[model samples]
Target: MSTISETYTVTGMTCGHCVASVTEEVGAIDGVTNVAVDLPTGAVTVTSTKPVSVDAVRAAVDEAGYSLV
Candidate 1:
């Protein structure tokens, strides 16, 4: 399967725990295979086996108490 990566600017992630929360939330999506969050940069990278919808990612971020910028 081809892997897809997406970079999203996430807000309200001020600490490592916030990053972890975002990571767990996004990583729970069906297509998502991996996730990385850079707290300082407010960037969240998601790797997936299939095309991951931006709306789904945004929803996950929102569920995690963060916003996609």
Candidate 2:
């Protein structure tokens, strides 16, 4: 299967715990293969087997206590 990578900007993530939280929530989504967070830039990159919807990613970020931009 081909993997897709999408990057999103998130606000309010300031530390490792924040990174872990975002990573865990996004990683739980269906078809998600990987979740990478760049704390310095508020960039969250998600790799999945299919294109994940922006709303789903936003919801996951919200659940993680962050805002997706």
Candidate 3:
């Protein structure tokens, strides 16, 4: 299957726990194959078999107690 990568700006990620939380939530999404978080920059890059819904991502980030900007 083809994969699509997307970068999102996430806020409130101040530590490793934040990164892990965001990663866990986002990774739980269907088709998500990879999750990379740049803590310093709050850049979250997600790779999936299909285009992930922004709303889903936003909700996931929210679940992690963060915000996707």
- For each candidate, what is the lDDT? 0.93, 0.96, 0.96
Sort by lDDT, top down from the best: 2, 3, 1
Q: Compare the candidates by TM-score and give the number of the best one.
A: 2
What root-mean-square deviation over C-alphas does model 3 reach?
0.6
**Stronger candidate by TM-score (1 vs 2):** 2
lDDT of 1 by residue, 1-69 (tens): 789998999988988899999999999999899999889989899999999899999999999999999
TM-score ranking, best first: 2, 3, 1
Q: Against the true structure, what is each candidate's TM-score?
A: 0.95, 0.97, 0.97
Alpha-carbon RMSD of each model? 0.7, 0.5, 0.6
- Model 3: per-residue Cα lDDT at residue 48: 99
Worst 10 residues of 1 by lDDT: 11-20
How well is each residue in 1-69 modelled by candidate 2, as lDDT tens digits?
889999999999999999999999999999999999999999999999998999999999999999999
Give the TM-score (vs. native) of candidate 3: 0.97
Clashing pairs in 3: none
